[model samples]
Target: MNPASRLAQISFTAGPAALLAGWFLLRPIHGEAEPGPWWTAGHLAWLAGFAMFGLMIFAMRGLAGPVRGGRRAAVEAATVVALLGVAANLAQLAIALHAGFTASDGEQMRALLSQARAYPGIELVVYTPGAQLFFFAVLAMAAVLALLRRVTTVSAGVTAAGVVLLGVATLQEGAGTALAAVGMAVMWLGTLLLGRGPSGDGLPATTPTRA
Candidate 1:
């Protein structure tokens, strides 16, 4: 198998899983009563997913190198994309853990609400768009890396286009949309790229050297 191909496999396995695992997280709401198990459950699920995603990224790092010339670019590209994804999960983990301390029970919620009323400092950190954007950007990059490893022409083209487009979105709405778009576009392009390869004569220029 080609080194690039192996990296592709690694990204495909871990990248997608990481993205899925860290999909959506909950944010703090000011002046709004968040007093319910149902609302809290969603947050818990998202946090769990983020943890699994972190593990997935750790797994992907082991798939690097030994790639042929052409494959090197793709592997590097994928690495860039995946690293951002890991960062996103780390941010979420921080937020989730902090919440545990503050959201212990009705008393805590009420107390935090009072603190927000008094100072509003918590609101700033809890609702900062920057953290959200950073997280999603990483997630999107993971998708891009995974997709990059797959097919090139159609799939790679599509994924690249997606990366740029999602990047734009990330700049706007935050990282969540960007990462979602990254995952979608990367997967689409990768599968497309995998469908075709180069001829031995160097016509299509498909495939890396066999492992």
Candidate 2:
């Protein structure tokens, strides 16, 4: 594979791995009263993961090749939505990191976070439905690629399952974090499989060869 394709593959694999690592790091203190070193590290990992995810989305778009009409439009739309989701996620993480750094104690951190959440649309956009859009968009793009034969149905379905598990993980607390980690692992495997060409080679199916 070329440098660009190699980079995309690395990002695709690393993004979810980072998320899983973050979840594991945060799991021990899932309900801790105060933000501490673990919390800061976890948030940092998530920030990096989401940033990589943004790159992964664009790489998937490129994998869709030079198709026109609805196919191209679908990939492009998914790419935009996924990037928006990534932005929202990053914003939320940044807020959390800032709160952790500024607050002297758990109560102060909570207050700071609450104050930030109280901002108009911040709760909705960065916390819930808005941030979740990224996973949905990624699943949509995976399905589109499957339809285009750019990726296998199994890979797309596994990815969709991972996304669903992650959504479910958000609804729980202690054990849910573990679930989220598993979900990220699943996503990593799915993307790894998706990145392979038709011959089961490691390179992306749409990767171009040199003359």
Best by lDDT: 2
What do the candidate models score in CA lDDT, each in turn?
0.43, 0.82
Position 155, candidate 2: lDDT: 83
Please count the clashing residue pairs in each candidate, in the order shown: 14, 0
Residue 131 CA displacement from its true place in model 2, Å:
0.5
User: CA lDDT of 198 in candidate 2?
Assistant: 40
Candidate 2 residue 67 Cα shift, in angstroms, is: 0.8
Each candidate structure's TM-score, on Cα atoms with residue i matched to residue i, is 0.41, 0.91
Off by over 4 Å in 2: 31-33, 172-176, 205-211
Q: Give the alpha carbon lDDT tens digit for every residue of 11-122 in model 2.
A: 8788888888787777767745368888898889889999989888888887787787888788899999999999999999999999999999999999999999999999
